[model samples]
Structure formats: structure tokens, C-alpha cells
Target: MLNTKKLLALTLTLLFVFALIPAAAQAAPVYRTLDEIKADGTINIGVFSDKNPFGYVDENGEYQGYDVYFAERIGKDLGVKINYVSTEAANRVEYLETGKVDIILANFTVTPERAEKVDFALPYMNVALGVVSPDSRVITDLSELSADDPVIVISGTTAETYLIANNPEVKLQKYDTYANAKNALENGNGVAWANDNTEVIAFALQNAGYTVGIPSLGSQDTIAPAVSKGNDTLLQWLNDEIVSLADEQFFHKDYEATLAETYGLDYEDSLVVEGGAVNAK
Candidate 1:
């Protein structure tokens, strides 16, 4: 009887200890603040590796794009080395929520649905959904699309949400990355390719056989950096950075340097979001 009681007590004690252990072991991921990142001397910025004119790796294996230009400035001002983490549109929120990235510079659009998951910094660029198609045929009406004629869309983008809600019957050939979507469009996999207007406009401008038939669709939106929700220190620092950079016309300068070659000088005024102020300060 004594032995059995001792064994039972030991089991209860072990069970109690384990019950408390999980509380510590399964603690939520803690995100690093500006100070912590400064101390480490590196900021992990998540960016798309396959989206050209916004974010992509060049033939020489170097990161180059409009968003990357802004990220480079952020690193230079913060006095930290940039550790660029190649990310996809779908994995952006996961990167922030899981503490895998200090900031997301992957052309993240500010939306109420996304703001609930991650804190978005002030606007840095203007954007809207647009559709591009082969010059032979332009799709202006969503009603024209059917299962026989699909639309190429990148996963986890506003384009996906807009189509599903507005035109559910339109068949979607979803790609996890933008490069694949571009390929599918070129290969005649879909009737039209939908994405950010800025990106689609760039595509139409640079590529020969495509044209942006629908230049603007859905609501006008802005692109901004995103940090882990509740990370106020980092958020404030980024906001301050934006305001400070505005004095120098930094974003316009970034456009001139990286995007203007593809988009030309005519687009400078409409696209550039100076000092993180979407409107008046």
C-alpha cells in the first residue's frame, strides 16, 4: 500500500511539472524591437525574390527592385546590415507572425483584414489591382471569363480576394509566386493576369506582347512596410524614418534609380509616396 501511494504521488508530481512546463515551452514567439535589431547590427527584411520591377534577383544574383531600394535606405539609416530574406506573397504574414522577419518590404498592401494580423507602417507607394492580357485579346469585363478561360493570379494577394468575392465563376490559375504567374500568362495558360496595378503596368510597359486592358480594378491601395503586431517600438521607428526621408525626396529618388528606367519619368509623380504620408502630414 505504501509503495503504491509513493508511486501515485510521484506520477502526480511529474504530471504537474509537465503541465507547467508547456506554459514555458510553448510561449509565443517574441519579436525583436528596433533596439534589439540595432544591437545585433542586422535587420531581417523580407522581400519577394521573383517579382520584377518591385522585387527580384537579377541575372548576377543581386536583389534589385523598387521595394528593395527602400529597404536599402532603411538599412543605411538604421546603421545595420540588411539580411535580405527572400519571401513569397503567401508567406509574408507568416514571416512576421512567426518572428522570422524583422520587417516585410515585399510590397505589402495595407488592408483592414491584414492590419488585424500585422501592424502596417505608413504608406510608401500607391497601388491598385490591374489585369494584363495578350495583345490579341483584352479582357475588360470579368463576366466574360469562365472555366474555359482562367485568370492567372498570385496566391495571397488582393487580386485573389477581389476575384473570389466579386466574380467567383472566373476560374483562377493560382501560382504561389509572381514569376510563375508571369510565365503562365506568357504561355497562354490564362486569358488575363491580375495583380497590383503598379506591377501589371510595369509588365505591360516592358513586355512586348502584353497590355494592361484593365488599368485599375478594385479599391486604390497603398504599399507599406509591416512589422509584427504589437511591436510599437519598431513601428514608431519606421514611421519616423519615413517622415525624415521625405525631406530628401527619397522615394522619388528611389524610383528614379530603380524603377524609372522601366516605367519612365512620366510615372514619377503618381506612384511615389514621399515621407510615408499618403496625403497631408
Candidate 2:
């Protein structure tokens, strides 16, 4: 027994609620399948433009690095061109989740927390945490750092997570980009910079008067490509491709071509993980 005006208001409210359902459904993460990517003729890959020897834009403006080499092979094998999307450490997962990029190759370390958000492909490289500081007062151990001496870390990295979890006494200077973190260290913003061992080692080698005092700080981890959650078709294809690439020792060659100068042959067998088979250490 409702009046005309009251009935009209009720009907409008129902319509409004119904209208929002489709929009809510559309807001869920969208994943493009492998076939769709191939049909598009191009795959978007997210990589760090500033993280050299891993993923970076060279002086010539070409994307060159270990991860870039692997990305090139993926594109070739898929019969598609690549569109490199510059990304930062903090935005890697967002890029995949939002469908902004089909794959993330930005030195993404595989961690349990990240695996729950984005589906990780097989690992291509092994990694660990390291700390680099000025040669004047090398920080060989976390114990050497005073409570006032802050450590530099990149946001959304394992280094930041580890320190936050393990060393509540230590202060941290967080940056969004690897370049900024390096600059912060050079500017003496922090006493030490904690990051991936590969990156810190490269920094010490390239920049004079810096030493990787705490090489191998945390547990060993692996670097892998990541796709949006529920992108099963692409995930499966990547796994298959990784295994297929093992026949030619593709990852080892990638290290030789891109990482050898920085890491040298001694790191070859240790860092390279062919066929995505990570032997239990």
C-alpha cells in the first residue's frame, strides 16, 4: 500500500543498486590470455628503467639488461613485439594487477606474500640481500649500525620487509626507485643501503669507494616473471617456454651477455637457474 511518489522512489533505489552490479564486476582484475596477447601482436612488459644490469634503458635509449634479454626471447617465441613499460620496484605488482602490463620482469623476487597476489613464472635467477656502504666505515654486519644510523632501502623490496620485520631498532630511509636509493647512498643520506645482492654488488663495483660489506645478508631467493593473478593461460605458457629454453642454456647465455661483466664467471653456475629448476640449497 504505497503512494505513487513513495513507489517511484523505491523503484529508483532498486535501479541504482542494480546498475552498480555490472560496474563492480567489471572492476575485478582482468587477465589477458596467451592467445589474446598473440592476436594483439604485442605484449607489454614491465621493467625497471633505472636498475642497470637487470633492466634499464641504456644511453642509446634501448632497453638492455639480463631481464630484457629474457623478455626478448619471450616475445620472439610468442611471435609478438614487445612494448616495454617502465616500472619501479613498488609498482611491479600493481602493473600486473591492473593489466597495465602483460608481464613483469623488473627483478621481481619471488616471495610468499607476493605469490598470493600475482602468479609467478619459473625463476630465472637466484638472489639474496646485501648491504653496501662507504669504505671509510664499512658496515659488515647489521650489529655495526647504531639506532640513529638509518639504512637505505627501496620500497616494496624484501630488504625493506626484512628490516621492518627483523630489526625494529634500525631506522630506514625508503626510496621508490633504485636510482633514488643509489643517489641517497651517494649523498650520505643513510649509513648503508640494503638491497638485492646483485644490485649492491654492482654498485660497489661500478662506484669507487663503496664496498658491499654485508654480501649475502638474508635468505636466498629467486627472481621470476609475474603475471596477473588467474592468468592461467599465460602462466602455463611461460612455464613451458622456460623449460624449452633450457635445451639451449638460454638463461646462462643471458647472464654471459648481460651480467658477466658485472658479476663475472664465478657467479655463473650459482646465479643461473636453467629450466626453472632451482636445486635445493
Model 1 stretches astray by more than 4 angstroms: 1-27, 279-281
RMSD of each: 7.6, 7.0
Clashing pairs in 2: none
Cα lDDT tens digits for candidate 1, 135-244? 99988878767679999999999999888988889889899988788889999989999999888888998899888989999888899999998899999999999999
lDDT (Cα atoms) of all candidates against the true structure: 0.89, 0.93
Model 1 misses residue 184 by how many Å? Answer: 0.9
Distance (Å) between predicted and true CA of 129, model 2? 0.3
Please report the candidate that would top TM-score against the real structure. Answer: 2
Instruction: Pick out the ten consecutive residues of candidate 1 with the lowest summed lDDT.
Output: 272-281
For the record, the alpha-carbon RMSD of candidate 2 to the native fold, in angstroms, is 7.0
Q: Pick the candidate with the highest lDDT.
A: 2
Candidate 2 per-residue C-alpha lDDT over 1-281 given as tens digits, one digit per residue, 9 for 90 to 100: 46988999999999999999898657879778999999999999998888778888988999999999999999999999999999988989888888999999999999999998899999999999999999999999899989889999999999998889888788999999887888899999999999999888888988999999999987999999999999999999999999999999999999999999998899899899999999797
Off by over 4 Å in 2: 1-26
